[model samples]
Target: MSQNAVVDGAANAVDTQKGDYPDFMLKEIHEQPRVLRETFAGRFDAESGRLKLDELPLSTDEIKAIERIYIIACGTSYHAGIVGKDMIEKSARIPVEVQIASEFSYRSPVFPPNTVAIAISQSGETGDTMDAIAIAKKAGTPVITITNVAGSSMTKESIATLQVLADQEVSIAATKSYTGQLAHLAMLSLYLGQERGMLSADEVADAMAELEQIPAQVESILSETSIASIEAAAAGCYKAHDVIFIGRGVGTATCLEAALKLKETSYVHGEGYAANEFRHGPIAMIDAEAATPVVAIAMESETRERMLTIMGEVKAYGANLVALATEGDARAAELADHVIYLPQIREMYLPFTAIVALQVFSRQIALLLGRDIDHPRGLVKAVVD
Candidate 1:
């Protein structure tokens, strides 16, 4: 039975109770595995090699005709769009452009006919995102929304909805929703790809198989042993005034959101840079007395070797290096001052697994700094206004 299912003996019946979990943030963070499973459940047919994006309004021919995709969102949702950019482009064989809603709103945009615009919002009430989609609709673009709230205003406005089953994510940091958006985006892309005849059945099945193992891998990362190691690493880095996260490819999304979590919760100067881009300017900030803590998402990918060279530059300036490596990557462990290993998964799907480690680590850093995590100062739960 799912966590939401009613037990025979229970009166209230369900997993609403927090049990012994103290902080809502921690509870929400750990709840991701369950929510992710829930999000994909009943949507995939393994034996038949089929994906069901029944929530998608457009048909196979409509997907085939899409010239491009424009994804607009804000905050964590925006980062998820970056992840979507990679997924949709590769899977569906289409070009994708991701825009921050506020930027997309003021700009005079021109989209070719049959272009689909996706506006992602957890609350379905972010004013800029709402406005961006409104403008897209006016220009005769079909809009689809990926949101957690069913019967939300955005859902009402859009042609179709991919509602995430994260339920109510009470914490302001956006844990499960980010992962949920990624899962939905992946599914949508694969569905489109299949319909468009771009992806083979075997390829789809392989990706689906990898996705099925994510919840268990996430569980491994959230385990007591894994959490203790990351907590210890955070304890070491908590005193640093500036924290930088660097990665390439899908790791870019990981670094971007991880940095946001740290800055939002702890008031630390946290920034993310593409592994190659870091050398251009940000690398200069790693000098003595700078005491910057570097969190490198060194998960194995085509860019793994390049990330190792970036670490060389970081070490040259004597910065404290924390590597988020893949499990059993001995070379990464050898190079960095500390290592927080994530369970092995496909590089294409690494962001979904890798970000969980950083999320847990950053929150522990916030707690070590004694910050009010649930109600971070100067931050609103949703940017509706």
Candidate 2:
């Protein structure tokens, strides 16, 4: 059932009980595999290697006519949009711009011919996202909303609603819902690619096969031994006053989401920068005395070499380095003070496994620092304005 079918739905489910897990955030984090499965169920055909995104209202001609796509969202949803932008552009061969909803609503964004705005929200009631959707619709653009909660404002406002099927995310810090968004966005991108003839049938099939493996891969990451290792790493670095996450390409979204989780849950000052962009200015913050924790997301990707170089630079600066590398990556292990090994997936899909590791690390840090991980201070489940 969608969150809307639940007792109170996402927006009012703040009092939702944390059944067995001590905190809702941890519980929700652990729920990602099942959430992803739910989101993927019935949407993909393994037999034909086709995506059945019947929920998408855009016809093939309409999708091909799209001049640009603007992805508008806020906070964790915004990070999901970043990932979505990458997936859509790379697979569908369409230019996509990810805009922070608050800024997008105020900015004079030009809606080119057949421009589409995709607004992502967990609660479907974020004030800024809804406003941005309104602005897009005012320009005669068909706004598609990817949201967790059905029957919420965005669902009604959008021309079509793509439910991520994460089912009532109770934690103020998003976990399962974010992964759900990624899964749906992946499917949406593939669907668009197939429709536009940008991706071949075999290519989509291969990607679908890879996508199908994500749930079991996530289960492997959530295993007791893996969680123990992540928690141990978190115990070591939770005392740091500041943390930096760096990556490139799709890893950029992973870094941004990881940093946000650390900052929001643990109250540590955390920042995310593209690895190449860091050397420009942010690298100056690193020093031995401070021992700032630099979490490098060197997940297996085209950017791994560059990330390793940046990790070397971080080590040279005397900063404590925590590397999220694919399993058995000796180079990352060689340079990192601590390494959280992740299950190796496709470069574009690494965010799924990589972010889960960071979520666990962030939760452990919150537990160590005695912060309320579920309902962090000064943050709410939905920024309803």
Best by lDDT: 2
Count of backbone clashes, every candidate in sequence: 0, 0
How many clashes show up in model 1? 0
| lDDT (Cα, tens digit) per residue for candidate 2, span 252-338 | 888899999998899998899999999999999986898888989998888889889989999999998999999999999999989
Per-model TM values vs. the true structure: 0.95, 0.95
Query: Residue 96 deviation, candidate 2, in Å?
Result: 0.5
Task: Give me the runs in candidate 1 sitting further than 4 Å from their true place.
Answer: 1-17
Give a tens-digit lDDT track for model 1, residues 77-184.
999999999999999988899999999967788888888899899988998999898899899888888888777778777888887778777778999889999998
Candidate 1, residue 40: lDDT: 69
Clashing pairs in 2: none
Instruction: Assess candidate 2 and give its TM-score to the true structure.
Output: 0.95
Candidate 2 off by > 4 Å: 1-15
